[model samples]
Target: MELFNSALGKNITFVHPKFFIIGGLTGIPNITFYYVFLFFVYIVSVVGNTVVMAVIYLDHNLRTPKYIAVFNLAFVDLFGNTALVPKVLDIFLFGHYYIPYNDCLTFLFFCYTCLSLQSFNLVALSYDRMVAIIFPLHYQVKVTHRFMFSFIASLWVFTIIAVLISVGLLTRLSFCKSVVINSYFCDHGQIYRLACNDHFPSYVIACLYPVIIFWLPLAFILLSYLYIGYTLVKVATGEERLKALKTCTSHVILVANFFLPLVGTNIAAVASYIHPNARIINSTLTYTIPALLNPIIYALKTEEVMNAVKKLWKKKTFINTA
Candidate 1:
């Protein structure tokens, strides 16, 4: 309230609009097809993550710190899509672009939290990978179940704090100007920029959040792998090196799937002009596809998970036959 009051320095009261019309892709051609595609992605994401979780729960062999992290990844992927894609369908497909102010904030909160956690979950996987290869003998001691669980919990706490602060700050702004948000969702930047008063603080957050959510986590993962590579080269034979690196294939693919597009999008935004619709499509796909792929990658690429899945299938078949 103070933040809003402070900005209300004039004779008039602050003007906060009742609703904001999300202006993202509203004018694009054939975007309904994209929305339909997003719905399909959401369904696949839900089913895939559920199967991953089911396999983990059913297979005792997967009850390790690493699979625990994988489980977290699957869950985050599931939640992120559920929070985002459906609302997207409702807004664009069903023509409910006018979102109430409070609902917009809630929408931003869940979307950002899950997005941030996706990156952190990658960090968790990277930590497990780093400890496993770099300190092979002490991997168990270093990456215990308690440690991974605690680490993930701490990450959630931190991520929630960051996202909440962003949401909380939005309450202080008075949207006297345009109420139409320019992005594909109730974007933090689009909403804050609509404020009629001082929004420097929000601008600062806008600059800082990408670093926290994207770059910092990304650098940590990359550096951890670098150290793992160094340690591997120092001690292991060529055959052993390939074997160690093989374990990282799924993580690498997932990381690249999530981060590279983000990096590219940012770079494209900076280097040249991009159609708003094109940017929206790129951003939406970048977040969604990796989620759909996460469980599939684990089920197909990781031998343990593949074996567990096959075993589950065989068990189900035998029981039905018997």
Candidate 2:
């Protein structure tokens, strides 16, 4: 747990531990159970995201640009869960926080790409919904399958450029002093803080990327929903109107689940910057809580997926009975 140390006449403090949670001490009751629980969680996350994507693929009715965007979002979630959860499960299993510098850098890049791309995917989904609701008659023509594919491909390109810029900047930073990362995962902000040299460029890029990418898209979602709501209120009336309203409710719920925690995480980061103790709250929100909430959101929002799962279970049950 030493923060700084010297090894063989050279300063070496890369593996020092700095912070400890109150309940994370060794010799806690049944610590093996936590790893078991984390394994189950990872399984559920991967399965849920995979099933959602599959449902969108196999169901012909679900083959629209709106659902295409959803499929991409689900794909992002798949990668996102993989990036963080397995490493976390390993940490829980081993009770060690050893991460090699090169591995750490690669892990950070992959993790950042997943999280950042997921954010972008959600924004794309929102915009897709906005266009459909705003122009129902022209929706099919405007957002052709070709257009959707092109858009998604562009996103992958842009994300790679953005991530390369961030990771490339981080690589240029001098890690002269030490290397041990404090958290269960190597978060970008936390890793940036570890650099013994100046990190001004890293700071500017981190702050600007989130603002331009996440916040602006969130604002667009809010604006799009408001317009949709106004349009719905003006036109909706009977059972058909009620059905029309239901179309967006699921998306709104998904958007809220996707966005609100992130907003909270950003706020927590600000609070931590000001108060220091608030980083725990920030870390919990960003890393721990999101892992559980994402699958739940998809399960609750996608009724078609729920129905398919139900059908799948019933079929398995019938076969077993026979």
Candidate 1 lowest-lDDT run of ten: 1-10
Q: Show the colliding residue pairs in model 1.
A: none
The reply for model 1, stretches above 4 Å from the true place, is 1-14
For candidate 1, give the lDDT of residue 53.
Answer: 95
On a 0 to 1 TM-score scale, where does candidate 1 land against the true structure?
0.95
Give the candidate number with the greatest lDDT.
1
Candidate 2 local lDDT, 184-249, one digit each (tens):
566667677777777898898978988867787788888887887787778766775567666677
TM-score of each: 0.95, 0.79
lDDT values, one for every candidate: 0.90, 0.67
Looking at model 2, residue 156 earns an lDDT score of 85
